[model samples]
Target: MVCKLPAVFLLVPGIFLACTSLKPVQQLSEEARRGLGHFHKLGYNYAETCTMDCTFQKVRTFTVDRRLNCECASYQKADSVVWGLFRAMEQYWMGLSELASPGLTSYDLSAPVQSLHASEFVSLSEGEVSAIQKMAEFAVNTSTGRFRSRRILHYMKDADPHLRLLTEKLGFVLEQNLLGLLEIQQEEWYTHYKTQTINSELNAMEKEWATEKHYQLVEDAEKIRLKVVSLVAMLDLIAEKHHSLAVTAEKIGSENFRNITAALSDELKDLYVVFEQVNE
Candidate 1:
């Protein structure tokens, strides 16, 4: 007999919530079920790769748009595994839509996406939860950048050979370019926002001093304002990024929660550091 799942099992926390315990979800067609499983695994896979490869080592801060971009798209173009995973999810969503709302015209799925983030799931099997938990832990320990040579510097190193090919082709490109882009953004915090603000204020002070014949006072004022403005910009940026990354991390946890209690604490802490740096 097929074991029936609870109706409200999708509301677990941490890595455990990633697996659905609801009967409705379990009842999905084999392809849909497989697709959902694959989709959830992608997040763990990325985390594992990050842990193994240290992919985010140099990424001090990044803009929101940059975070979503897979840099390897250009090199692998039509065959990026990460992008492919995204597409696969889209297809799964479509399949679900056809099943849930047959003959309904122009149904929007934005709510489902939001619901996924809001709900949690319990796993039917402890082993499945354990595997995912391992990946999350790996992500925490690695802090990004070790997976490259061991996993995908030349080719993907996971169990799937095709996945290895895809990762080697696309992962390599994304890891390199994304890290560079993150570095650029991190540098911009100091140069663009901090230095620019300081320089602007200093220049204004200088112009005022020249006009009033108060050269000494002007230099002193410019120096003070420059330091003050730079400090302010740095603090503001760090705070903003911290908040944003924190929220995103929460969303990830909620959407794919399986073992709620264990995953939340560490993931939240990881996000806090990331956000703190962003704010800095």
Candidate 2:
């Protein structure tokens, strides 16, 4: 993308205005917004691919109901749940970004937020719960007319735990369930086609065709695997950076905090560049 964020993130008009100097907390939240968007899209596709491949792999034997039960239904439900999780996470980050922004001061601010809740998919630490609650209490106070301070400590601190919880669980799902399913499908393709290559009933052209299809499956699965691996790494990076910001919450505009956020945004941008190159 022109801004070195994922295409998913760039689709939003001005979340990361390169010309504007955003506070450390605002910058971090926006970076995370990009990361979550890109990963969520990949996860959505992975879920569908997993279910579809599993269904067709056993197409010759299972009844429609059996196929749905064995393959499609669980992943379909998982997909819906995952979508909800990502949607909530995205909104949380966007709200935080708005909450922490400098330009939002004295703006016509009503409660631009709903009551945010913790999702069932993740169990937050006691520290996380306390932190978010503190932030929420602060937000309620600030809604009277205008936010009096620019110190983003409360909001960043609030975001620290939820960000970690959400990304950690999302990465786990991508690695354990979606990636695992795709790898299994890729292996099945290899084995099935390899066997067909030697089948006495198949002519040379038939074997060649099977080999080509097998290669296509491998190539496609490899792309998904690479993307999942990249996203998992990105999740870890963002969570760790957010934790650093939370720790430095008291020193919001200090050189240390500035350095941390600058390094993070650069790293994230570099990663997105690498991602685009790979995808192309």
Candidate 3:
């Protein structure tokens, strides 16, 4: 009879095969982790920009109302303040849109997070890769559109029927922006995989081996989407607040006007929370 090989001889090759099988998955997980981090950073930048813009819009309306009604000297003061705020907000948006000096902006807000090129993830389905690419492109275009919308508001007169029309237009643009973001969040791929959690029963080896690149991408995308949803909610609140403030400027000193301003200020604070959460 032939002699049988020892158990250790069989075990060595099994271990080697297991490690070899897991190598590509390990690389994919690491790459996906880094990419997801970058996506969060980009989403944070967008939130910050939106918060700044919303605050500026509110203050601008208040200052312009004061300028329209005050004596010459007071009007000059209000105008100066409005001008200063406008310039600051404009430059901030430009920086966020990646149109300003890179040395000045701390974050690279220019491009969308790139998730599709990880070589270890070569097994990722074409549909999954396409979905990520589409989301990235939507983010870039949305940022650009927001900046343009703000620019349009910069030149609009803060008086009368014109301001009403302007605020309406502004609100519409904001609504469209929010809707676009919601569409991405509602995409089948994002919704399908967002509920999946890491398996607790998976052993360390199995955990690494079973990691799916598509799941990682979907999770990261959902994080960005949630940040965006928060931001859009805040912006929508701001738009309504500004419209109300603009429409009621004639009663600026009335009790009702004061109450509206107080409410708007509280809402603005809520908007800041979105930015703070992302930074933290």
Candidate 4:
């Protein structure tokens, strides 16, 4: 059983000196009081988290507005979900680049290097297997659901060269730019790490190792981060633009929904304030 403080309301009559003939208020049992206390605590915790989340959402929305209002408004006016999808694609790519690992893989080796035979090798150890499994599971679950831009393209598969054309463009651009960065990093590593006394064979092996690692990084970045980002951004943009249009249209038809939306947005801002507090 938990102890609980009496509610302020329970003391109101005493403070007011209401000398009525009514019986004294019923006393709460220890168990009940404890339960009430726990309930209050839980409520407080939820309120705190909820307030913070709302604040963050508002701040995020506002920041986007400040920077991309023109795009938002224009895309909304066009009433094409595709614009929002495109924006989502951009956002997704940006998020991946900013938030996720670029080139390195996380894994626990299947076994120590010592465990490998003198002639045999374990390319992917146990740790590596787990990491690969996790990565694959994450991709399969989130990518198609969140990243696909079906709504943007709609049924115009024939006329919409946007998907295929952009896919190729993005692939090539990322491969050259980001992959090139990986290559340069590798070359620098070799120049700095290889020992001067190493034999020609060892030197060659070191160089090869550097190149292989660089290649793997580039490949992983493209597969995991770049691809996901591009698709997610496009989809997000599409939905956002469409949502704006719907809001605008509803506003023109009925003012009530518009006001409600406005109020909701205000509450959202309050929530964003929570995030600002955390970030600061």
Candidate 5:
């Protein structure tokens, strides 16, 4: 719970009123950041998930060209792009959480090594991408041996749209790209295992073993799908919450702001509970 601060609404040209309500917003943004911290693992899983296409390419190379070609990084570009998007979005939310606080803070990003590649797969405009990417640069500029002040309402208003778009794109990448990969993997598993089970040359024991493996694969794939889908839902919720906040910016501490935020807090808590189960 945010401890109430008295009468900040009277100070700083109505900005402190905004700050007084920001702890919840900051908490929301922090939750968003925590959810994506495991993106490296997500990217690795995307690369390694089995696919019949990958197998076919490898086999064709070895057979036709007499070459031992292991396309181990088949999804490396997609992984890198996802990594870049995650990093950029993380920076934005992290900055938002920091900038919305009541006190001053500083953090360095001057020499942060992160890929920020945008691809044709991303449907964002160059200007929108640039705006999100600058969040890191903003941190670098503000935190260069100086404790920068917070309580900026205009900054929040400015970033809200671009950040919402980023949240959306992240969901799209996860659902469409990663989930698509998993679907292909499941299909490949079905084809591979079913073929073995139906092969007349295979003994009953071998066919049974193949059938068992197929069932296992199906179960595992379902688990991954549920996890990824939950992430997509979380992203959608974040965007919705952010949109609500942005549109109600002028109402900072009004009844409208309080009502929307109160409802959103409950929604966030429910989603956070869901994430706690998978955080392990």
Candidate 6:
């Protein structure tokens, strides 16, 4: 008996050829993708700001330490946590950008609106969707890892009760002395820092000015007293934003996304308890 190709294959000549289709892929909806990009960018902006504020606070604390001849290692440690949190956030945004626009090779974090929000939606392949899901999980895991390492409660133990008081004092001083200066002098600080090329002379001048300002602020015992308080507020804001982002990610993601981010949820609960205690 002469064997022949299967009847079905004969009827459809290329049906069993195992060729990949070149058909266009469906793109993610504009609203959904824009929302995702918005939240991702918002989280990233907050993280970046928190990092800068925390680092400035660290330097201020060190200035106080030197002037008063005391140790503020706890506050310094807290700053380190802030740095780690921002680093994790950067990674999260990168992962999110890759997920939302797999074809794009680079992301412009400073862009007012990430290009993901362009009118044309980017198509995601099946493999890309699966990769996106994995990336979301990784983002959540990294967030959890950053929080776990921070041990906020321990660092804030001696500092928490004074947060409100310090906030008030520092807010007043900042409003009186620094707010206008910041607005006028550093209105473009963030943008300039990212985009500008500073010569060594300009860098040295900025360093000198910063050093003088740090000493002046430390000379005011009230500011020094409230340094940790300011740090706590920054920390709280960052933690809150991080928790919100994780929740948003969970809502827009898969069942596995929820499971992977459960740790972040639990950590937020624990953080709330600490916040409540601090408030009391």
> Cα-based RMSD of the predictions, in order?
21.4, 17.3, 32.0, 32.6, 16.6, 20.8
Candidate 3 residue runs with Cα over 4 Å from true position = 1-213
Q: Best TM-score goes to which candidate?
A: 2
Question: What are the Cα lDDT values of the candidates?
Answer: 0.35, 0.65, 0.40, 0.34, 0.60, 0.36
Model 4 lDDT, full chain set: 0.34
Error of 6 at 17 (Å): 19
Instruction: Write candidate 2's Cα lDDT for 1-280 as tens digits.
Output: 1222123332233322222234665777788888766764463355577666757666524546633644456667777766665677778778878866765643331232122223444344545544445444444434421232233566667777887888788778877887887777777777788998999999999999999988987887777777777777777787888788787664654678778877877887776765555576
TM-score between model 2 and native: 0.68
lDDT of 3 by residue, 94-120 (tens): 332333222221333223323323444
The numbered model that scores best in lDDT is: 2
List clashing residue pairs in candidate 5. Answer: none
Give residue 212's error in model 3 in angstroms. 5.4
- In model 1, the Cα lDDT at residue 270 comes to 47
**What root-mean-square deviation over C-alphas does model 2 reach?**
17.3
Give candidate 4's total backbone clashes: 25
Better of 2 and 3 by TM-score: 2
What value does the lDDT take at residue 151 in candidate 6? 29
Task: Give the per-residue lDDT digits (tens) of candidate 5, residues 1-280.
Answer: 2332222222233222222345555665666666555454342355665434566546534556555344647566676777777788778778877765645333433233123223333344445445444554444434431222224446567777887888788888888888887787677778878888789999999999989988987876676666676666766776686677676664444576556656665766676555445544
Candidate 6 pairs with clashing backbones: none
Lowest summed lDDT across 10 adjacent residues in model 2 is found at 1-10
Tens digits of per-residue lDDT, candidate 4, 1-280, equal: 2333223333343344422210000011111122212212211121232333344345435554443212234323332333343343344333322322212222333353224312233344445445544444344333332222222123223223453444344434334543444345445444433432244556676767756754664454344333333333332233333244333432222354344334433443443343234333
Clashes in model 2: which pairs?
A: none
Which of candidates 5 and 6 is the stronger one according to lDDT?
A: 5
Better of 2 and 5 by lDDT: 2
Error of 1 at 31 (Å): 16
